[model samples]
Target: MEVIAERRYQVRGMADLVLRIGKPEPFPDGRNFLCPYEIDGPLTQRRSHFGGVDAVQALLNAVGAATIDLELCEEVVQGLLSLHGQSGELGLPDPLALTRLRSAGTIG
Candidate 1:
């Protein structure tokens, strides 16, 4: 799969993690679909420690275990949703509302 975008994040000043977004591929049923993004680096190499759990829980546990900042994780998740056109399904406040809040120093 072709990588459409990639971002590298420094993990706790210890290691670098690269998150790669792949180009969407069309399914045999003629539906456009994006594959799960690829993650590489030291953190991923330890994922076996999180194996056997449900995917969502595994991810949450892994994030906690890595001690990544919560805000940074939120931004990454929101960016992925926005990139994949699923942002509207997030049930969060409108972007404009968030902007206003930020401008008002309500959120950082």
Candidate 2:
């Protein structure tokens, strides 16, 4: 599992939190199916069956839970989204625009 992207941030003066995205690989079941992208971190070390978008959402949730800072979480998520080459295929919103909107008090 090659790491495709990674983000690192401190959590409330604790150890640095690391999140990594692994390149999607074929399932071990040999059913000619591709597995979900791997989401790896110090806290999130388990594999998920979710697809592209849900995988990102799961990562965001984990980030939120760890940091409890919405803006920081958004920044990390945006970094991951930007580093991942296939992010456009995930059908997610523009993270930059989302950040701007949040800063402008357009969304809560």
Candidate 3:
């Protein structure tokens, strides 16, 4: 199908899509059809979503082997992004700075 569709299904926790095959459409004219084979993204992305592959992996895990909706994926992505720092906006707040502050016990 389309990338948006695939992404949507992934975030919504819908059906799983696995195998994807391109087959010729049985039309008057010979044309190929992209068939998305459904499987299980959730199970597949479990190990992969540990470090930095959370968005894609979560989508896959949510809708294993199923086409997902990009919009939904965007929403999920935003949620994930919000979990990083106090503001939840990309990048981790200087771990070294935090370490120094923690070691000092207090900031002036």
Candidate 4:
């Protein structure tokens, strides 16, 4: 999964992205695809849109235009970047594994 931060040239702030991508391709609008993902801008809640600059941007855009919170968006971006960096690392536990461990009281 390739996540890119969506920039609102006219506005500010960002949000999280969860995507269901297929494969890389091109579109009629000149947007390239690594997978099929979309988000528009900040709103009261997350809304789905397409043709974002990247994952972060898609997520931020998905958030809609009604609500734009810079701190929250930046925080989410950092968290996602951290997770992205941890991906495929040998010692790191996956989210499900961490959840299972916490549930079993093996980790807190």
Q: Which candidate ranks first by TM-score, i.e. highest?
A: 1
Q: If the candidates were sorted by their lDDT against the true structure, best first, what order would they fall in?
A: 1, 2, 4, 3
> On residues 5-97, what C-alpha lDDT tens digit does candidate 3 reach at each position?
322122234343222312212222333222232223433332111111233433433333222332133333544312223222322234256
Model 3 ranges with Cα > 4 A deviation: 1-29, 37-68, 74-78, 81-108
- True lDDT of residue 51, candidate 2: 28
Error of 1 at 36 (Å): 3.4
Q: Which stretches of candidate 2 lie over 4 Å from their true place?
A: 29-49, 52-108
Q: What are the clashing pairs of model 2?
A: none
Candidate-wise lDDT, in order? 0.42, 0.42, 0.31, 0.35
Candidate 4 yields a Cα-based lDDT of: 0.35
Task: State in Å the error of residue 21, model 1.
Answer: 0.2
Point out where model 1 deviates above 4 Å: 45-108
lDDT of 1: 0.42
Worst 10 residues of 1 by lDDT: 45-54
For residues 8-92, what per-residue lDDT tens digits would candidate 4 score against the true structure? 3112233433222223334456663223333332332333333455544444333332122322343334443222345212222
Tell me each candidate's TM-score.
0.39, 0.35, 0.18, 0.19
* Ranked by TM-score, top first: 1, 2, 4, 3
Q: Report the error of model 2 at residue 17, Å.
A: 0.7
What C-alpha lDDT, on a 0 to 100 scale, does residue 94 get in candidate 1? 41
Clashes of 1: 0
